[model samples]
Target: MTPETNAWDGAGKRLYLQEVGTRDGFQMESVFIPTEDKIALIDQLSDAGLAKIEATAFVSPQAIPALRDAEIVLREIRRQPGVVYTCLVPNKRGAERAIEARADELNLVISTSETHNIANLRMTREQSFAALSEVITMARQAKVPVNVSLSCAFGCPMEGDVPADVVLGWAARFLEQGATGITLCDTTGMAYPSQVRALVADFRQRFPQAGLTLHFHNTRGMGLANVLASIAAGADRFDASLGGLGGCPYAPGASGNVCTEEIVHALQLMGYDTGCDLPLLLLAAARLPGLVGHDVPSQLLKAGQRLDLHAPPADFASWRDRALARDQPQTAVS
Candidate 1:
């Protein structure tokens, strides 16, 4: 293919980003971020031009104590008119709670890998699907959309090399069961660029009208590269977290999700319209370190943007003049 026709060319394209920090990220934090603080941060993110925000998970508080106040947080936060506020719902009860709390959407997760399904959800894939199907029906009755997130879509920690067909098979099932979208999750950061391109192309071809979102982790440092690949393969939506906070509890080597600010910076530089406010995102990311009480994996938060130039040393001009003079050839005494 010519350069113009290259699949990887995403210049001038529009991309949508969904912020998953408050729900996915905070669940992994050892110290629970205060409920008021969570609301404030999410309100900040709401104004940062994100298309969607996963506010919190409505699962059992015992399962994820950090997000125990999901109901309160969901109710208290100020919702931006254009942004969709979603909540993770693990079952019928969670879905009911999320709907009651006025979540705009419900995100349900089921792993494509059987071992991971058991490890994460403590149920077989079929059981999880059946259970989530009921949640989907309940959501439909409530007039809320459901987005199913397929974990280990790339590879599984316990059962490695989950086939692309198996991944898409699960996606197909969810889509057939009234899921409005499918988020292909690289649960352990196992996705590489080539793998992402192939699977995303297949998904697009088969499910052209379905909402496609890619979720990645930076554990192998391939998160941004994978995002580019997915974009090339026609995926325009992605899931990211501020400060790169989040990991799979069941995956041994799991790490944070792709940093939202870093992805926005890279995409904007490439001429893709991400619609996110870089400065606002950075400001929000900056608060994560203080809230989580530790440094985060967000490079943009640490190094600033690539074009954020620094002033030169005080003596640089004099030093350059002396160095240039020394390097100049001296004429022999003529």
Candidate 2:
């Protein structure tokens, strides 16, 4: 293929993508992934050139048995330079563990909806904020960057629509607590492109100093659409899982996060630089079915990438004539 014909030849635009397959992707899985396999997969992703990777969550083994090996996974993976390895810390204890594990960043989550917060976090909205405050403080002291994810920022299953002010208010408090960054999560995939554009705009206006990361789900099949809208709204970062392997355990009916390769392929087609090796990401995505023991929702996995064109049939020149003859003879189904 000529240089002009190649889709990946240019760095059109820069977009930062954080791979969360190891943490969010594995948490919902019922099958227990062996630590060695998990380490192997993470090691493979490490060389994919992602700027950040959420290596694992520091939740209790009882809460998420699939990620019980967070410590080992964090310790064993080959830490590549210029790559930030982050972990989810649900509380002070998780923060301490993340600190010991040498996580480059600690991700703290607090739902924006009171209903979702009580159900999933087992705490009131205020209570979750208060608790995460301490964790953020500890991260600051430990010299670990704190990224707070506001779950259900778009809409909630229980609560129909989330007001814009409520999300920004919560983010303001988290920022006041010394959070280094913020991630707006469409936990149930209720976010549309218009909603995403508006939210990102308001968020930048309200909290201009804090870093923003947009987390989306493909529940309603708007994941990549929302990514484009967000990018247009000046959102530079995103969280996507390999093979669409994530869902909220607490949020009923919530499903997988956006597929990594799907959006990566879309961005690459549009000339955006996501800093990832698409072939390697797809290779890693190829192994998810075996690890989780089921098929995943990856468009690229089923339909090959745009450039993977198939050759015409052996008797290509006769196809049109054959079809025309058949149609002419069978006209009107007489």
Candidate 3:
């Protein structure tokens, strides 16, 4: 394993990294990336020490044409030890497909707002809950762990300002139905830092046993701030895509997710151990533009690292020699 940077030397906290690039990143792209490339990307991510990877979604091809090859990808990708490969499932059928693919974990999502829920799933909140209960039961019978994701947990684009009580109530129901984890998703990037902190704290208090993960988009440029707030509120797991790839089709004007490199750099700087190698992650980010056939939105990919200072073209070798000499005080003195 590559040594982690002591960037967070004084912060004294450990953060978990969930690389959602394969699933979330590819979901929104208009171009089709070959399954071979996806597999290669997952392998690279696994080598980077990300504990969890959201590999693919078993949603309807009619709904998400991009993921039509979910089963093929799931079956073909090489699974590395210690990395959890998770797949998103929309309903019972999707859950069955995920199980058939032998997915390590299943993520089932439902929107909190009734209007958004209906619009997205073509079912009422109550109906979706009933469907979710069935899906959870199926996964349990199949011995698959289920992660219940409550989207629009912060504010809904359709209904606006979803009540905390509503989210909490839905979470309670999901847990009662046997969800092993809960992921609060800011689908449209409508969450603020304070709201994120308050919600995470409340949920942590309410569901002590349930593993919580936060998924935020950067549409409003508060994604990292929200992540910091959530971390302060005791959240360790978070979802981020390489180059900030992904946006909800239902959310108008919504942008990509928090960039994986940005999140890792932030956590590392704050003394949180993400177990990711920054240089390797940057390499992966650099490959994204070519694969997606367009420039990505990740800041780190554009600006490079703080340590990546450039030397003038003239006497570049001398500049390097001087820097090396400076590192060796006796040699510099000589």
Candidate 4:
């Protein structure tokens, strides 16, 4: 295929963004964010016109105290008419709760590497997949679309390189078992642009009908770059967290997901239509520090957007005035 075919070029090409701040970002936090704050943030993101939002995850309260109130948060958030609110489901019980909470979509995560899988999920890869098959069945019965996020698809922190076929094979299994979409996650931020391009091209070629999404972390600082490469190579959907809030609690050296504003800012400047309100998204992101009780890792929050401008400093202005006065003619001054 030609290069143009992969790009969101010309007019009318729209890139879909799935905001995962509430679920992914908050999950890894040591301090628990209030349910009200979570609801408010979700409302803010929904108001920003994001196409999709990962609302929360259904897991054991003792396991992830930060997200223990998933049901309450999921139930309380004001649902936008066109926005899809999804939640992560770890197993059959989680899937049942997600179904009861009326989640618009069910996002299930499984690692491709055995070590990482066991570390994160507390189960082997095969065990996690078996559990996911049951979860997928439950989601199908409940009429809730399932989105399986394959973690460690790029490389594992422990096992190192996970082969391309392993990732594809896992995706194929999920699809066969009735998953509606696939999200390839760089759980430890090990993905590169070239690797992302090659994998995306292969995925599209092999699974032409499957809905594809890319999830990246900025741990290695390639999150946004990987996003561009993935999109340029024909993948459109992506997951980004506001203020770059989260990483895998189990994966060593893992970091927060790609920042939503940075992605939007970059893509908007490149002439792709995101349909997400960047200013509104920034407003939501600005609340991260207060809510999470710490400064977030967002580059956009620190650097400001592409058009945010500033005048010269006061000292520079004063110096410039003095220089102008000194350069003037002495006769004129006399």
TM-score against native, each model: 0.94, 0.90, 0.89, 0.93
| Residues 116-162 of candidate 1: C-alpha lDDT, one tens digit per residue | 99988899999999999999999999999999999999999889999
Candidate 3 C-alpha lDDT tens digits along 31-87: 888888888888888888787899989998988887888998888877889889999
**Any idea what lDDT model 1 has?**
0.91
**TM-score of candidate 2 against the unseen true structure:** 0.90
Candidate 4 residue lDDT tens string, 255-317: 588989888888888788898899999999999999988888887898898679988786997
Candidate 4: C-alpha lDDT = 0.88
Report lDDT (CA) for all predictions: 0.91, 0.87, 0.86, 0.88
Ordered from best to worst lDDT, the candidate numbers read 1, 4, 2, 3
Prediction 4 TM-score vs. true: 0.93
Cα lDDT, model 3, residue 203: 91
* Runs off by more than 4 Å, candidate 1: 1-9, 248-254, 324-334
What C-alpha lDDT, on a 0 to 100 scale, does residue 197 get in candidate 3? 83
Pairs that collide, model 2: none
Q: Which ten residues in a row have the lowest lDDT in candidate 4?
A: 1-10
Candidate order (TM-score): 1, 4, 2, 3
Candidate that beats the other on lDDT, 1 or 3, i.e. the better one: 1
lDDT value, residue 69 of candidate 2: 90
Q: Model 4: clashing residue pairs?
A: none
Looking at candidate 3, what is the lDDT of residue 201? 84
